[model samples]
Target: MKKDFLLSSNDQLEKFAGIVNGDHPLKKVTPEEKIKVGVDLGTSSIVLTVLDSKNQIVYGAYEYDHAVQDGIVVNFMESVNILRRLKAKAEKVLGRELTTACGAIPPKTGEKSAKVVANVIEETGMMCTGIEDEPTAAAKFLRLSNGTVVDIGGGTTGISIFQNNKLIHVIDEATGGFHMTLVLGGRYKIKNDEAEKLKRNKEKEQEVYSVIKPVVEKMAAIVQNMGAEINDPVIVVGGATNFTEFTTTFSKVLKRKVYKPLYPQFVTPLGIAMFDE
Candidate 1:
């Protein structure tokens, strides 16, 4: 992908981050305008994204959560409740109800995983428009037709290869941000929750990255082991890629350049919204 193309996507993600941070006000949705919605049920958080008919972001919200583990919903009702609250929050901000939403799961999790995700979306009182794999959605949001998309969520690092805009191969591994938290907790002799907070602290990021670098290397090794003809513009997205050194560490291990977008966490959610039809 061209650098300017990725820059444009990052610009959109930057705007979405501002809206999520309350730095940018939410855009209003007229009554007749069709609003597309997306719900991302991640291991550490559940994100709700609203997009205009033309795929422009309008609103986005998320809540830290543990209702999901890996790509599966471990606590169905909790997932429903979080999504419902997010839907209510978006509706209040946009002054219109979200009628339909698309959701996503880690690749190859099977039809059951998709059903659970869609169920959660419907439980929020919005029609479930569709269920897509996470990397596919991330690729869509990045406008990537060809390249590799590695979606690192809280509980898993999913590697996907796309050719001609179609997903040709995908695999999800059981290692991600939560593993980093566990490593930090073990090293600092703190509980997982405290370690999670410490891992996200910008001031402590250097130390945290040092402790977690091995785990990231393992994730990259998974990609390398896949033995696929890894394509250029290898993009990494999702919440687990938040560390500034993440891509560099990953690239070192994989022996290839890696790309990442601003607010890496919101990529899948924003892309899921584009699937709402």
Candidate 2:
């Protein structure tokens, strides 16, 4: 799927982008009196984020856990427990109650997991006010009126095609971080846990990318199979694409501008906070 392509030659990626790695930038800023939080029970990790009235980051936290796979919760109690911890931390940091929150599900995985996602957030001591598709939630911050938002999760790569800020098509396929971990596990004959850790280590990234290149290719192919012209810049988020070179490979495959934010992993969870109601 590797092919050369030039840059977008447009301001799409930069003009409509959201916060890039708010961990430091959002700190020390005055938070709104009222705050809204979002919980993303991702397949590889559970993330809790807080946004103020103006939709700025007030607090954010996440923990790694394979409680979910391809967006379906496998260990409901474990997920609940993680969210509980995250909520406590956010509340402590923000010095306020976080009683209600919003959450999201991967594309096509919603029918079976949307209620579960909302329930997980609720069980963690907060009222689940809304449950939205992952890509839709991300769109709240991306504000890209036209383009594709590709959510590369732990176990699935979700594609959402939008035209004029409204969703026109969506797809979720089994391919993502988990696949990369699997490849690393097999290559090193190590446990899945060890592979996951190694995959995230800066020292091992170069070696790991060589092994996970195929998995990245699968993600690019997933986007390609969507059967659209897909010429606009593709905005990628999620932990899987956090690997430095995933977009380089994806851009070559699609022969189009593929943009990944500085903190791709936080994009969706933070965006989820925008829908708080």
The numbered model that scores best in lDDT is: 1
Model 1: per-residue Cα lDDT over 89-180, one tens digit each: 88787878889999999988899999999989888788998999999999999988888999999988888898898888888888889999
How many residue pairs clash in each candidate at the backbone level? 0, 0
Candidate 1 positional error at 207, Å: 0.6
Q: Which stretches in model 2 have alpha-carbon errors above 4 Å? A: 1-32, 229-231
Cα-based lDDT at residue 137, candidate 2: 79
Q: Please write out the lDDT profile of model 2 over residues 1-277, one tens digit for every residue.
A: 1122212212222221322233253444443476778889998899887777877566676888879987889999999999888888766766667888999999888566888888888887789888888987776776667778899889888888888877888888988899899999999999999999999998888999999999898789878877565637588888888778888999898877788765677778877888887
Candidate 2's clash total is: 0
lDDT of each: 0.90, 0.79
Stretch of 10 with least lDDT, candidate 1: 1-10
